[model samples]
Target: MPSSPLLPSRPSLLDDLAHAALARACSAFRQSGSESFALPPVLVDATLGNGHDAAFLLSCAPPEALLLGTDIQPRAVHAATERLAAARQERPDCRVQIFCRGHQELPQIWAELPPEERQRPLLAGVFNLGWLPGGDKSCLTRAESTLAALDFLLERLMPQGCLSVHCYTGNAGGPEEEQAVLRRAAALPPRRWRVAYCRDANREDSGGRAESLVLMERLPISRREMRVAGLCQA
Candidate 1:
């Protein structure tokens, strides 16, 4: 008998730089410490894009956790809703809510949350910055709105919660948005937030530019307070 050819090896999740960020973000959520809330923790996808990130996060979320996604375009919302609905059919226990709104509207959503909902611990927030994939390229995320939404997310993140942002450098306004986010993340009080940026050194776009993923994790209140006091005394 003739020898059978071996099947091609499956691609690693980290093979794609963008997917690597999603993997890291999910890992952070998995490794997070327990929260005191009665309800399952919440995860927010600030940009729904093609719904890939939102769906991936939903698939990994705790059974009762709520996955919230937002997009400025009606089409994006509809697409994400469809994708999530399909996901729910397989994972019937998952809960997902999507909104047709800009990322900056996150603060409004926070305000609208009921007392009980507001009390739920926020586990993770994800941002895929730039224009929505396969959509109008001109409708790029603005630095101002992205910064505002990021600030709101950091404020609500639970102790040990994580925020991950994947910024593409090739699109219009992409560099500005990336710089603004980086500056804000860097300015976050180091005692309260741990910030890390990862870049694929070997990869470059057509313009020889590179993308980056920024991850910020909130520290415990006691630890933050101790560092603050130490700084004051010093």
Candidate 2:
């Protein structure tokens, strides 16, 4: 006999027995081996606010892998550390490095790593600019450092990896910085980078309609060719 493509793959139950019962069982298996595949790449959370992003990064990779979280404010760093410490309760097996410096100095951090390690792929780099939530309002991410970090990311970001930018444009100097970043994003060529801009899902971001989330991916091709393709795509 021949099999029918439309037939069910699993056996069907015939008797209801005048009652219905359903149960689902989930079993989690423990994994002991270290990630043997080149440390599973690196991830950079440029503004590690509350450490949520850092914690998530650590969760995705094994403990020996490299994960970096950076911020310029001392308080912000403290908050991230505290948050990460809490996350350790759930994910005690992961490792992460935190930096308390502006993004403009990332090149120095990259230089400090071993030569062979520097060539490893970058998984993802994210930026949440503007002031820290419920923290200091006087301080914020500047355009200079943000752009510098973006340049570094664009150069070294892993293939198919994404960089997400969240910007707040209502505060002082925020609009100008947003404008500069938009111009820079607009200039990216299709051959080297693919971009998608979306509205933040939080309701708090609704009233202003000024906040934006920008995601960019580095393509496999060169910038010149990408730029030309972008012209044609338009």
lDDT (Cα atoms) of all candidates against the true structure: 0.74, 0.64
Which parts of model 1 are misplaced by more than 4 Å?
Answer: 1-36, 202-209, 220-234
Clashes of 2: 2
Residues 13-94 of candidate 2 have per-residue lDDT tens digits of 2101100110000000013122323344567878887776566555555444567789988888999999888666665555
Q: Which stretches of candidate 2 lie over 4 Å from their true place?
A: 1-39, 62-64, 89-93, 200-209, 220-234
Q: What's the TM for model 1?
A: 0.79
Could you tell me which 10 consecutive residues in candidate 2 have the lowest summed lDDT? 20-29
Position 165, candidate 1: lDDT? 85
